[model samples]
Target: MARTNDDVAAMLEEYADLLAITGGPDFKIRVYQKAARSIGAHVTDIAGYDTTELRQIPNVGESIARKVAGYLRSGTVPQLEELRGRIPAGVRALTRIPALGPKRAMALHQRLGVDSPESLEAAIHAGALHGLPGFGEKTEENLLHGIALLRDAGERVHLGVAMPLAEDIVTALRAVEGCHRCGYAGSLRRMKDTIGDIDIVATSNRPKVLMSAFVALSQVTEVILHGDTKTSVRTGQGLQVDLRVVPPDAWGAAMQYFTGAKAHNIRTREIAVHRKLKLSEYGLFDAVTDELIVSKTEEEVYQRLGLPWIPPTLREDIGEIEAALAGELPDLVTEEDVRGDLHTHTELTDGHASLEEMVAAAAERGYAYYGVTDHGPKLYMQQMTLDKALAQRERVRELDGTSGLRLLHGVELNIDPDGDVDWPPDVLAGFDVCVASVHSHFDLPQDRTTRRLVRAAEHPCVNIIGHPSARLIGRRPPIDADWDEVFQACARSGTALEINAFPDRLDLAAELIRRARRYGVKFAVDSDSHAVGHLANLRYGIGTAQRGWLTADDVINTWPLDRLTAFLRKKQAAGVSRP
Candidate 1:
């Protein structure tokens, strides 16, 4: 039997509530909460551990240990099951939405039977929710608005998705007379965490021609707003897109104005002022003469001030220009640099695609090779045992020889709370690569959590650390851990850090990757794709690599199959016998 992180999280959450109800010590409740997180982040199964092993966990002791083991042995832990009966499932779901927390969910659930999104919406519509305590008109309206926003934003989308759509429009607009340069601007240009609208800025002598062309783009669902200098439309996906056109002479200034983080532009203007210049959408102007000075390109605008042109993505005022002046600008990662995808699941272990299908997808993308890693047996979902993993690997070998894409069969083996892989040493060794990840135990303290991952990285078979922090941006923060020590240990041990490209969990944020790179640690840009559509996120992963100043050489995936294989084999040879 294996326990998942969700199981442990639910259990500990129930236990903490029970402890509070029973007047248990505050620290004691904290322990269970921490244990739940640790268990959630545990790369392996918690159920595999016996009572003594569970007890040995940093936060778990005799009492909590017994509870955890009991929970693993059966579908329900006696204590938590009893509480689940009391708590409405709808209340729990409420906490899952952004901008809402458990306390708010609980209150909404208890007051108006808002057990689900539908019910909450109904309550809001009828004005029934407004009468509840702490529910004023403003709060009620805001909640309703929040719910609508969340409902509208049903799925995650990024610049990659929006860029092509925008570019296609730009291509058409470029054909119009007088069009000089056209590209996406705004958050899409800055590579912000998320975007609601696409902003396109075009420079040409014939602004009217460009603007007219934009209004007629094929993807436009509805023309929301249109004008000579600017035009906006609603795309089929409910995104608002706005386009602006300006004269060529002011193209550089116009681009700088449109490619704004507002704050970054403000700073740039301040810098211009310090240099006795006036900055605007037209160009840098002479302060005393009130005349346009710099022109031609955005690069020229920046170069006039002794700064090199900053890539649109690195335009955020995170020391980009300073680094630029010193010739130390971060070498952002690019799509062509990624050599392999380390964390892909196949039908063998809860992946939607068959092994062959997985191989074909990678081959089609021209990936040098990919690690066909799937979940190992632990939790109930497609519990792939050692025998299953080996069989999958053998099939992968046959496919690899003929598939044209290098296929390395591996498992997303779980590490138990006691810091052990789900399989025996021999079993792990039989594979080409291993990615040790924490699927459960998300609540562990900084010290214990760091130790758990360190233990996994120290394993000989493990080639890469998958989704090191397990954070889903704007949804869930990564578990609190000593990042410096963890990255340092990974660096010393020669483990590669993964940049998971799932839009929600762009784990190993660019900043972290940059820091890790300073220590000479390598990175893998993985889609952690569960489906074919997810493969496209590889570019987002590459963008992260680029923002981190990573070069193709710094990425293992960019290595040709031969070099990548050698890197993996080298790790295996250096590893000690698995305990």
Candidate 2:
């Protein structure tokens, strides 16, 4: 098999570490690290290249190329294996976990005999890890908490969570006089699901006035950190909100800098640096003239830097700049593109809106159709019964005749750990559509989690996979699984991925959306609304699609009623029988 980029990176990383462990010179160690980085950043398929081509690169030498060739041929780099034997794999895995550095890992291993994450967790639970030499109880507690937090979250939260909090803050801030154009910056602006901290940028002539207004907001119960230009507050929800005031002229530059993934901005700045121009919060400045070039808008700054306007979500330090230069920055999806919502709930289940009320709300939003997918038999918390669910579907059908909206009688079926949904074949076939979801067994191992999800996706009646990872914004991490494998199964099974638009459950983040898109897996941008007010969450779901570089064509719900029905029919025709 050909060597994957991850394979090459792992080998290079191991080699770099071996060089260091062997007391090699810092420059020598850096050479291997550089080679690894160059391999990762290379946009072209390095796996497609021969060993000779790999060696021709500036960083990769003959020895490294030989190792690459061996890895490609045998699926193992002997050098990496040797290094793994010399150093401990447990120590390396510990480094990958956030907050636990190499020194800390070493200390934990030596003092507490906690070499692996499992062992560390055991130590933590037993209260055996309170304080060690050179480490205090506070540090241990922080480490424990960090481990749990990291374990709880994937890389980012779904856009659904980030957008609402952002809007709420903006609304509160906009109430302040002189608070001109208060908007969210950072990943939240980019529509990232899991935001680190809410970055609110306000352009104001009277910034102090706005700042005073911000600190006095009802949502902000206590100010954690405050300053003249910036203020940090702990909200009612366990989230930190940061507000920054910038001059009107510098709004664009400041927004660009502040609403960044940092790495993305650094790459953008590199382009500026190469052009003998400086880009910063102040604005873009010409190096030779030492004069301000662009100051009013982010668009002007990008144009001045000889680049296309890049979206905040695509600002991963990846090859987006080159893509932008090549005019290939994806044409992202918009709110107008979303034709309808799929995985919504009604008062028949745990929802606060009645069937008529929900359909009327969807019609008011000009949707051609809406899927009233209330909770199914497994989620008894919603107090749903088979007879009541059937009655509810009949009621939806009843309203559809007069409502002019094509209503889909759908059920959000809970996929048990054994991969069985609560519905039999007769019941499953009764509904127009079914969304299979995992509501429990969150802490399953990687293989089991992957299997459980794949099994659910493969269900004959499962038209869509609802929140495949079962992540709850900041509170719960996604189930451990090979998402590529899971999405590939979804593609094979003709199951669509639902971007649940509930503020707390944007399960599939933008990156996953991008991956699923690549796998030819379709998406359903669902409101997953529990009440009338939650119908507005469609915007958050649409924002997520945009951030994922999704177009209208990429989403299943964007299709008209007939097209959607045809797609469902096709999926049913091709799918296998449920076990």
Candidate 3:
């Protein structure tokens, strides 16, 4: 079995958690956690290297390298297995609940024997939690709420969580001796906002070796099935991944069959039937003689059907087939089309990096411009006072010339309950760009929420509405709002809505973006990055935008620097003021 970088990382993370619960040395636990972070963030496969090479990776010391080597050589680490034996798996799962750290989880396990979510819920309802230290009525209530949220978020994982795991597994599969090609398919490949499970397809001569290696991955906590052609496993993160190996002759057909929404595949099969051909996971065959036709590439399959190859993102049976037949498929926005990131943060508020560092990171990515839109004074723990804002602006101005990147000094002003910004007009006018956002009152009535957004959009100083829907995937639903009304106001007022690139908040979802496009609403795909590493989230935003059928022209950040600057200036010049 070939281990991926994520496998090593997950093992280390689990080791750290179990060690912590078992009262292991704090320094040792920290070392494992740090090593896990380094491995998880490494661009390439750390598991492919020997112990000496592994030690060269940042935060991976001699001890961690030896453990990693041991895990790769054998299926399990002795220390991790020992710790797992001491702590029940259910207790470890408790730590994943909100507000339940390892220490608290241990307390629950030792004091009340509450190990799982169900047991914890039972304890809370039975009033068994009240007498425990640090567990009051309020704490119990919060725990119950968290449990409900967890239950509601069952089975599905966010794109951010699932994507890396899938990529790691795919990388591992590709490393096999006889593997020709391997890639993820299904919803993850489609770049859906949330994914249920991951599906991977590969072409390989040695199906038994490929399947065996896949099921033996370090991340595989449980193997559901193992066969010559197919293997399925559940990872440590509770994501089920299935890998299928096919002959080179059936590569395209296998990919098309597995990378499907059931409806889309049904439609395609229906088309095949109409053409007097048979399409299956094996290959396309002639109806009369059953002769195998082309099956090496997706384009070949589509060509055989007399249709242009549709992008995987648009294969949702959402009029994409008709559009392809008519030669009208949208030239969707790609990551390369983006010129800048309009919504970003800095140390002045909640961001991890300084303004100069953030700007340098953006410039490194070949961005023409980067906005410094740290939070304004309204957001708790992330408040930027007027003095701090002014000082930050001055700093930005000083670095603007020497930084070799165009820096737009800006602020992310909070939209209050009344749909009004916290800052006065003069304060708002001082910045080159202002992103208005709602950080509170997510439960407002739909009409009130719509009015609030409309009011924010109508403000002349506002250039973009940040994370307009404010949905945290798998955690919280989008705030109730009449999106059509809000879109109308934004289109009329020239305020671009943001496709927030944050993995957890791919706001202004694809479906909504598609509908808003009808009203001529412009969009900005922003990273809303708090740290330099988070800037990579821009790809997820671009994927979401593409899923919405957005074009380069539809996203303002894709415009040239001069054009974008001119648009912002025009919006500022409109002279509309807050009521």
Compared with the true structure, what per-residue lDDT tens digits does model 2 show for residues 322-357?
779898888877778777888888888888988888
Runs in model 3 deviating more than 4 A are 1-154, 401-403
lDDT of each: 0.74, 0.78, 0.86
Task: Please give the ranking of all candidate structures by lDDT, highest first, separated by commas.
Answer: 3, 2, 1
Worst 10 residues of 1 by lDDT: 38-47
- Give the range of the ten consecutive residues with the poorest summed lDDT in model 3: 39-48
Global local distance difference test of model 1: 0.74
- Backbone clashes in model 2: 6
Candidates 1 and 3 compared by TM-score, better number:
3
Question: Which segments of candidate 1 are over 4 A away from where they belong?
Answer: 1-181, 206-240, 290-294, 401-404, 576-579
lDDT of 3 by residue, 1-579 (tens): 222776888999999999898788998887787688667645445545889998977678888898999998886999889888878899998987867788988999999998799999998888888779988887887788768757855468878999999999999989998999999999998889889789999998889989888988899987756888888877887777989999977889998988867657877888999999999888888988999897888889989998888888888776677788999999999999998899999888889998878888998898878889999888867756899889998898988856467889988989988898878887888999999998989999887898899999999889999999888987788898877789899999889999998988999888788878888999999999999999999999998998889999999999998888887877768777665
Residue 151, candidate 2: alpha-carbon lDDT:
68
Model 1 Cα lDDT, one tens digit per residue, 400-445: 8565677788777776665577777777778888887777888787
